[model samples]
Target: MTGPLDIHTARRRYITVCVLFWLPLGLSIAPLILLFTERGMALAAIAGFFAAHSLTASALELPTGGLSDVLGRRAVLAAAGLLNLVALTLVGLGSAPWLLGLGMALMGAGRALSSGPAEAWYVDTVQEHSGLDAELRTGLARGSSATSAALATGTLLGGALPWLLGLGPDLGALVSEATSELVLPLSVPILLGAAVEIAFVAYVLTALRERPRPAATLRDVLRGIPATIVGGLRLGGRDALVRRVFLSAGATGSALAAVELLTPGRAAALTGASESGAVLFAALACAGFVCAGIGSHLAPLTARLANSGERAVMVSLGASASGLLLLGATAAFAGVASLVLATIGYGLIYLGLGAAGPSENDLLHRRVSRSGRATALSVQSLAQQLVGALTGLIIGVLPSGPAPWLLGGSMLLAGTFLWIRRSGPASPTEAATPQPHTASSSPSAVGSGPLQQHADQ
Candidate 1:
């Protein structure tokens, strides 16, 4: 009998979905960075924009996530893509700061709309077709890889397009020879990205599919917000293991966001490479993402080798924190080589995190009811956003120069230590156990014991 999830079909679907989803994100990066630069905006202004963007998206995440649970994932995803198309268009055209901010806010709304639903759709669809256990790792890994690939392609295009279009340094030289007017080259990529987003929306509306409706009614949806928040918290609170996972994930996410925000400046300063330096930093970050994708692909193997999900999570977090610390410290005192090395470390950490993420998600999913799963996941999403916002805010308040490195390193170290403390120690014997059995098993299996034991090991 054919399983609901045909691996080949699911892989194609996952890749297609990721491309549709991440292309906008990838296209947005360079253009947005350039947008701020072209507009003569300060880092503070950009940070403010990001903070507001994240806040608005965070506000909308729960409701939108619940909507996906009720209304149908495809509908939500399509809406998200359309929203992105509109947002990117506005961003491309707008010259004024207010207009740009408005566009950014709209983009954030689009992001919120898309975030939880798309992942849920992928997971649910694959599980329905192939079975959860069979499809989870491959599907998630492929999705992550597809997103990274889109990001890499977009970053490269974003950097290369202006130069190719006769709007870059060569254009400046040409203009000096003629009109003596420097054409702002950054806007070109923004316009191009807007075009790409428009195409993505069309693709999503045409290609994306949804599972059967899992929830109905506005009340049901509204009720899900509190239920999800409380239920996820309750579940995490009760389980030491789950709580550790959430905390570690949240902390790592915060540190990463901070690192991302600061690294470009550090790269530019250290390399003396100008605006193009930031683009290089972005490319390096994407490299880390590629590593992460590879790690996610190898997650099953890493988990097997490590012997426990908790240990894998802990190791990944530690590695990521170490990378952040190294990046910050080296960038503070050293040159471009250190920056590159830091990036390499960042890549390794991402790979580890990618490998661990599925295991952590699987652990959480096991603890929550189907009805509440989306909501619980939304809470997790919220934690990530909240942490990101906090990190940005902190970085904004801190002094410049190596301050970012110090702050990032401190947060990472603190977060890592806390995660380690929360995770505790795993015995060597505990890890070598076969699949479908956890360390915390009971001799007398009863009711949910067998399933729980299977999951835990």
Candidate 2:
């Protein structure tokens, strides 16, 4: 507290926080849909469960950000971890539809609670430690890369653990009298996830600290949160650039939902067996995550090469859409060739998303003040969740394969056009230049002038 925060320290903590929070999520993903089916839930019901999770997360997103801002990021994040611990436990044990849905709702709440607080803490700490004009791109990019690596690693582990368990002792037979036959294998990854959530809580409690806010009090915090939420809501309505970014977030979310919802099944069809499909999907998922990490690491270079963040986003989104189109086009093919194309397409989709994320967030940070930063991020998340939910419902009704991918790809392609109509704030490189600060009475006053000087650059 006495010394200024070093950039390296800030960056390390940011990446660590991201890994801790997202790793459990990644672990659960590989087994989640299959687990539900193993428990005998119908397709429609499974879709409902996913929709419930998304709606819960979307509804709570803005309010939880307010909670983070008012109650302090550490406390809110700790609570989120605790909730996730409980949720993962319930999910691991519960076999009934209602119970599973309840677990999902709790998981959504935890997700909403955890979404933006850690990143907000990182930025606030960095700005406090190293002045407002300090370099942020490299640190942010590293954090994104760390998250993708965690997902890639976790997905592979989660997928392999169950099969590995089956290969070992008959743990399921021991519990067969107490639970369903498939319970033991399906529960392993989620139980491991619950354990990780415990670690996440402990880390948040011990590692993160809030900067002193001399003027902040219980009454002021309660009053300010609502005002902050309103300001966040106004961001999209009032700012053309922010609105365009929000639209893109929605479109990208849909594309992601398509891949996540459809790809495992597609992978299974390629192998013609559930067990083998699961294994193949796991390998593909891991590879996809690696590609994501590579893309995230390349974001800054991509932006510089394109001469602007907006241009970088378009390039990335175009690549993503093209990948999805490749997926759709190759749907009719069978055997190793189809599998190869699908894998490449899936990897490219994640690559684009991973590359676009840091650039998008960097621009967003320049547009909003610290007071509303978390809330703005929450809004961005809300857009994704809302669209993701819609995408799930649409995909559920649509004929399997190709059709959903085509729709998702079309939406992503449309998202790219949003940038053409509006110019956003200056690119990250331009914002990294030194600038003077001005004192203002407004709580939302932040050093963003240099951040917005794209016209001159």
By lDDT, who's the top model here? 2
Over the stretch 1-457, how does candidate 1's per-residue lDDT look in tens digits? 1334455665686678777667667766766766776667788777777766777788887666655655666787778877777777666666667777777888888887876555565555655665434335556656666776777677777767666757445763464346332234555566666677667667656655654443455555555445444444454555565555556556656776776778677668655887667767877766766776676677666667767655555566567667766666665556568756876666765665566666666554444433344545665666666776687878888787667766755665665565454344333222212222122121111111000100000
TM-score of each: 0.79, 0.86
Most TM-score-accurate candidate: 2
Which residue pairs of candidate 2 clash? none
Go through the candidates in order and give each one's C-alpha lDDT: 0.60, 0.75
lDDT of 2 by residue, 96-127 (tens): 88988988999989989987888788877887
- Where is model 2 more than 4 Å wrong at Cα? 34-48, 95-98, 171-183, 214-222, 334-339, 399-401, 421-457
The superposed Cα distance between candidate 1 and the true structure at residue 327, in angstroms, equals: 2.5
lDDT, model 2, position 174: 60
* Model 2 alpha-carbon miss at residue 399, Å: 4.2
